[model samples]
Target: MAEITASAVKELRERSGAGMMDCKKALTETGGDLEAASDWLRSKGLAAAAKKSSRTAAEGLVGVAVAGTKGVAIEVNSQTDFVAKNEIFQGFVREVTGIALEKGDDIDALKASPMAQGGTVEEVLTANIATIGENQVLRRAKAVSVSQGAVIPYVHNAAAPGLGKIGVLVALESDAGVDVLEPLGKQIAMHVAAAFPLALDENGLDQDTLERERAIATEKAAESGKPADIIAKMVEGTVRKFAKENSLLNQLFVMDGKTPVSEVVAKAAKDAGATIKLTDYVRFQLGEGIEKEESDFAAEVAATAGLTK
Candidate 1:
């Protein structure tokens, strides 16, 4: 039997949102495998599906820039939120976002690209770290563009003009003019920020995610003592529901809370007397997927003083 450590229990609790004892027991039952423990909790109806986005604790800003029909979103991480507020840090993020808009979102390529001021993007970042006196990273960038329509950008909880905690870009392919596209695109971008859709459509949902949802649903259905065919149908329905809830096009619009996003776009196109298609979108939330270590200040201080915690 594998030993389940306190840190393992803490991690399982964070991942599954189960109680301490429940998480500990799940870890024990699953031989201390974090992923398996999560499944165990979900199967027992002790926890909801884990959402990676909720784990965000890193301090940073997500910057956005746009040119005609093209937009880019970038994330720059810092060791502390105080650093994220610094003018120097924000300026670097904004400038690098512009470079990404021009070049592309490849991390290495963007880092290697020359900055408008002087040195390469990576060099500027290094200089900023020394000047700001905190460690930082050029985490990631994503670009979205359309052949003809408007690409709109929005920042949520903005720290500056184009820098914020969440950056979103919506690419619309249509014959509609900016007068029609800009407002609509911005609304959709805001939706992307608030809704946090996993993908643009059903086809874009990850297979692994779907399988995991299916497994949970199967375990849940089996608990009802239903027949095999009924259990299978129940599992399929649950998976389909999960897809509809997480897919951008299928999700109900946050604005109206009733109309599907696809319907919203279609209605806007009808009103504009033109064709509108949502081609692509980029939603960058700062620190998403990067786990920040949780520290106990009291415990550390006690240990440093050579006292028992």
Candidate 2:
């Protein structure tokens, strides 16, 4: 049997959000194997799941750029928010977004592409890390374009002309004039950023998510004790409502809260004297789905300064 130290127990407790004694017990049960202990706790339902959320991802910046009908958005992460404020790091993110628009959103291709300063993107990033003194990573990138319409870009909490903490690209495919559609597209993009719609439409929602909603609806309808036909109608209604609420175009306009987004697009088309269609949209929020590491600063300081129990 492996000895379980206090620090090991504390680390496990912090990672699993379990009590200190439970963490110690888990460690002891698994012979001091951290991964095995995590799984063991999960099997016994003592921990929620076997997920290890120790990666710190609190520092990152969102970048966006638009060129004619094409637009690109990216999120670059750093070890600290202080690095995000570095002028060199910010400039790298901005220029890389422009390159992403031209070279496509593939991270490998972007890294290989020539930077504006006469070196590969990767080379520039490396040089920036040396100068800025922090580890940085190109997390993700996305591009949107329209043949006949505009791809409006929006950056929330902007750090520069085309960089921020949240970036969105709304693609409107239409023959409509910019004067009539730009504002509308921007409004819709803002709504998307705020609402974080699951998918573009009913068909785009995940199969498991759809099944889960259907199961919930079926259970609720079955509780009514109605006839089979009535229960079926109730379930259908529930599913349809779920889709409309979760879908981007089918959702009601957040600005007016009355008009459906599809109808809003239609009205814009009429006003512009041209047909309009919302093809797609992309919204990127910093550190989404990245469970950051938790730290007890007071304990860390006390231990580091040799003042701990």
Candidate 3:
């Protein structure tokens, strides 16, 4: 049996939000496998539906660029928060965001495309590393465009002109006047940044995600010892609720926290004197799922000084 350390138990507790003893037990039952232990805890109804609480990602920048009727938001991540303040790194991110706006949503294509200053995007990134003196990367980019209405961009914690740590792009598609929809779209984009909805609608969400939610809901409903007919209804209701909460259009607006986003769009349309639709939105929070390596300061110092234990 794998030894369940205190740190492991603590990590499990933090991830699953279960009691310490329960976390320890889950770790023991799963032989120290974190993901399996989480699933074990959930199977016993000891944990929440979400798998684990990811580490706080507070170290990156959000970038936004608006061009004509389209807007792009890009997130570039570095190992340390200090790199975010570096002018060279910030400039690269801002330039790349503009490139993203021009190139659209294909990350690989964007990487291959030419940058404004000189070489290809990849070449410029290589040069940036030499200049910035830190390992930098173009993490992810997303673009939102509208044929008629407006695509508004929002950057939270901006480090430069159109670059920050959390970027959001909202596309409002309508024949409405830009004067009316621009502010509303920007507000909605900010809401998207805060809420981080899974998708625009149920159809946009991945099949695997839907299946996972369904499985969890079905399992929870089955444990009630209710009739199959009642359980089916309960599961369906739970699924619909899940979709409403996770889907962007169905989600309650974070700003007001009362009206659904769909209703907010409709109200904006009425005020703008045209039919408006929230065609799409893109939000990119830097280093969201990436885990950086934790370093031991004392060990590093010792190694640097060439001390032998």
Candidate 1 residue pairs in backbone clash: none
lDDT of 2 by residue, 219-285 (tens): 9999999998999899889888998899998998989898988899998888778989998888999
Query: What's each prediction's TM-score?
Result: 0.78, 0.73, 0.75
- Alpha-carbon runs more than 4 Å astray in model 2: 1-55, 216-235, 299-309
lDDT of candidate 1? 0.87
lDDT for each candidate structure: 0.87, 0.82, 0.79
Local accuracy of candidate 3 as per-residue lDDT tens digits, 1-309:
999999999888888776576688888889999999998977765564222122333465778889878888877766579988888777777778777877786878987899778878766765555455455566677777878878888878777777777778888888888788888888898888898899999889888888898899999999999999999999889888888898999999998899999999999888767999998988888788777668788997999799948
Q: CA shift at 172, candidate 3, in angstroms?
A: 0.8
C-alpha displacement of 183 in model 2, angstroms? Answer: 1.6
RMSD, each candidate, Å? 15.3, 12.0, 16.2
Query: Is candidate 1 or 2 superior in lDDT?
Result: 1
Candidate 3 vs. true structure, TM-score: 0.75
Locate the minimum summed-lDDT window of 10 residues in model 3: 49-58
TM-score, prediction 2: 0.73
Least accurate 10 contiguous residues by lDDT in model 2: 46-55
Superposed Cα deviation of residue 25, candidate 2 (Å): 47
Best by lDDT: 1
